[model samples]
Target: MPESVSAVLGPRYRAVAVPVDGGDLHVGVWEPEDAAATGAATPTAVLTHGITASHVSWAALARALPGVRLVAPDLRGRGRSRDLPAPYGMPRHADDVAAALDHLGVRDAVAVGHSMGAFVALVLADRHPHLVRSLHLVDGGMPLLPPPGVAPQDVAAAVLGPAADRLRMTFPSRTAYREFWSDHPALGPYRDEVVTAYVDYDLVGEEPELSPATRPAALEEDIRDLVDGASVQASLQGVPARPVTWYVAPRGLMDEVPPLYPDAARERWTRELPTLRLVAVDDVNHYTVVLGAHGVRQLLPHLEADLR
Candidate 1:
């Protein structure tokens, strides 16, 4: 059985199984309180999370955007969709994202994506142009080419750090998991109710032994492909010239200085992709750039304008 959206997001949301080639993709829908007044045509936004994250990662953003509808999917191999069969990559995820939109009767929506989710969002907009109104990329979606001769594993380690290692580590209890995250440099500083909720939702099974909902093998495949995949390069190379915005955090996953995309690289991206609007967000790291209060405020305007 797939995970329940209401289980994590509470009553205002609904979960649906969107059929795709591999299997049922789980999508969570967060409707505004005035949904009835707006009727069926209420503006919608599609929220896509990072590689190891699930639909619940967008709960904070959903609350920030009260009037607009939020459609977030657990992507293949994560959260409720963890059992989804292999062949996981950006294109497959893109297809699943498109299918989820169709299932929700959403013809088009503003695509909001964070980290790896940003790559999937770009692919979706590229492959299924009709379904995207505008694109808002949060610290991802742009090309992330690894340095020459670097292995995929090294690339994953450099990019994800403790986040990737946590997949293999087991926790005796949810509290243990929370404690582990509380110590993480990226997640530790911005500890709040929403962040705690996001961390708690990542746990599965019972006490004495609990594992993260993210599938390690799937995550590895995604990282390998993301670093050197042909499809990913194609997507980045061919992003639509539609209204697109990108937000980059000053810090990395470990709250390290210089961040994942350095100044030279960012300048190069702007030179190469003139259509992309890149904004520098200070103080917050990669994780905070999506889950933090300041990050949401910067993203709200782009999301709201596109929804309108």
Candidate 2:
């Protein structure tokens, strides 16, 4: 990484607590260098990270695109943000993001989401179309639910595996926690630069306990809320005509077992959401597709070019 990228990303990126209508939560906002001193408002790009990770998940991209101001809020109970008060779902995640945008006085700008965040982004566009200028999804697609006869336990384990682990865990120490994450299925593919920064940004205090900057139960609540009562695909209906797009990793989570995402299912979504623009990237898994140089490369055109 260049000195400029390093400086902007920070020797250690700071955590900010933003006051929202619902409550105070943590977020990591990276302002473009050109706009920092001048206080000139630049086009802000807010990224809602995936289910288990925090803003650090976007640090690599944020560093890559220093020209665009980036805001990555810890979704309600994930990252550095607050945990669930009652229960969480996609709607709550959207509400949290809407509050952040309002606090920032952002009228309209790009809203990007990844994995589960993509689902939340879709919900936002569906419920509050006027608030978004454009929407971009990186390695996140319209979540088509598993076909019938699928056991809820099996579905929950696969889709919400990491969330389940978090809820059931008590790390002996932060060192143990870090060790556990070093081999995470999703994050293993990122560059060392990204991995280091991603880890460093989320260290809270001397309790020596590590988490996504949110509580474990919060993540479970979020997953249940998003997938339990309604078909995950139904949320897409809310974002109609919002320029939906997907940067799909050709290999989905199904490779592990029971095949969560089938090609036929993907085709079905593409067919149903006729307007969705999907750009499939080859030779990448669910994790690597979102973290490497190629991942960052795939993201630029969507955020900077297509929106124009």
Candidate 3:
């Protein structure tokens, strides 16, 4: 493990395989130091990563929350769970999370998610309300307005751009992969040991032809659902009645202006889901909204308040 991973994980981190329908889901658990000492039960949080990300994305948040048990899963078709068969979609991902929580004996967790994971979290809260006490949707969950003239299937490519494009390319070595991300406008500027470890974990094949661990099929299926699936629409409609907070990032995936949820869209959603609390986190893009220090700083207070 890299020094940063070691520092973030500390001594209580462990990887477990939670059995789902087809195969096991890879979950990373970070238990608080006092878990064994025990009086009151430890507060638990279930974290879901982005569409193309894995459990490793929660390293920084896990490190910050030493008193709360953080359960983060690599949603199907991403990270170590990439091999797990998928009839992949938001419902499937949500159920997988519920299964992980059941296997771990966790109930009433603060559900946190980023990017596409936010959609999964929303569905989880809707379908498995007993398991989620409150929702912290980081930079996602609202239905995105696809660019005009773009087909429904093309929305992912249009929004994700290089992130979606890189899945088809191959890298000769891990260094090449790191360099590729190092040049990313959003991730590159914030590269550190944690970010580097995240990049390293994303490569799974032989050195000569390593590719991103996200399966293109999974991405395609999930993105399609995210774009226009009925389930997501229903979840969005149900948001007002649920305990939910959406953290918005001003910048986008590629550090571009007009974020995934721009002001106009935010206003519309606000009008629809009157109770939805929106916090505008400036100076961070979609990726950094969770992965970077500034984003983490802004998120900690809200998360801690919810846990309390």
Candidate 4:
């Protein structure tokens, strides 16, 4: 029996199954009763969540922004779209956005991406230039390239952050998984109500074996790809000459220091691309930049000043 998604999103949001590439993509769209009142027709923003997170992370922000439509996909192998084929990278991720735009018939869009979603937004500019008119990169700066003089062992820890307890990461029960999230340092600040539905739709179980949609291979591949960078970074060789806005948080994964390459790369790219712009938000860590209400506040004014 297929899981009941309606049980997760309540009745306010419509769950649309978008078929693209090699699978069906699920998009949660918020369309109020009165279109004009909420600025639905005029303001449309397709959002992308960061790694390890789903559309639920963007729900508060999407709800707060007036006069805007919101479309949040679970990304390949995540949330409701867990069945998407593998080999996921930024380009294929960008293709997912393209598929969503084509399905929604959005000719030109104002795209907002957070973290991994930010990378997807940038790729949308590079790959599907005609599909997007403006871009808002949240916390995901330039493609983080491997730095010089960094050792292999240190590289993984430095770039991807504390080694994922990958081998030790699977869970056998939704209750346990929910508890894991409750104690997660990153998702802790978020209100329980907002993420409760998310926890339901995203976690999976298989009797004595349960786990998230996240595949260890995909995670490892993503890490390897970031380390390799020959593909995604090369794809960013020349960004579009349209409205491009980037937001960077003040803090990082730990109390140590934020990865400097991404910031440096964003600054460097800013100098090169005429339309490329940058905004650095103070007082928030890298994860908070898109996880909590405070992070959304940090992005609103910049998005308004630029997009509006």
Query: lDDT by residue for model 4 over 173-257, one digit each (tens)?
Result: 7777678766655555553555655565556667447666655555555554444445557645645566778787766654235
Best by lDDT: 3
Candidate 3: residue pairs that collide:
none
Off by over 4 Å in 4: 1-12, 36-41, 145-149, 152-157, 161-163, 166-168, 189-191, 195-200, 206-208, 224-231, 234-237, 254-256, 259-275, 305-307
* Over 4 Å off, model 1: 1-10, 147-153
TM-score of each: 0.93, 0.83, 0.96, 0.82
**Cα displacement (Å) at residue 254, model 3:** 0.5
Candidate 2 lDDT over 135-154, as tens digits, reads 78766646546557666545
Candidate 3's TM-score: 0.96
Q: Once superposed on the true structure, which residue ranges of model 3 sit more than 4 Å away at CA? A: 1-8, 148-153
Q: Give the clashing pairs for model 4.
A: none
Kindly report which residue stretches of model 2 are placed more than 4 angstroms away from their true locations once superposed: 1-8, 11-15, 36-41, 147-149, 152-154, 189-191, 200-212, 225-234, 252-260
Alpha-carbon deviation at 67 in model 3, angstroms = 0.6
The C-alpha lDDT values of all candidates are 0.83, 0.65, 0.88, 0.66
lDDT of 2: 0.65
Which 10 consecutive residues of model 2 have the lowest summed lDDT?
252-261
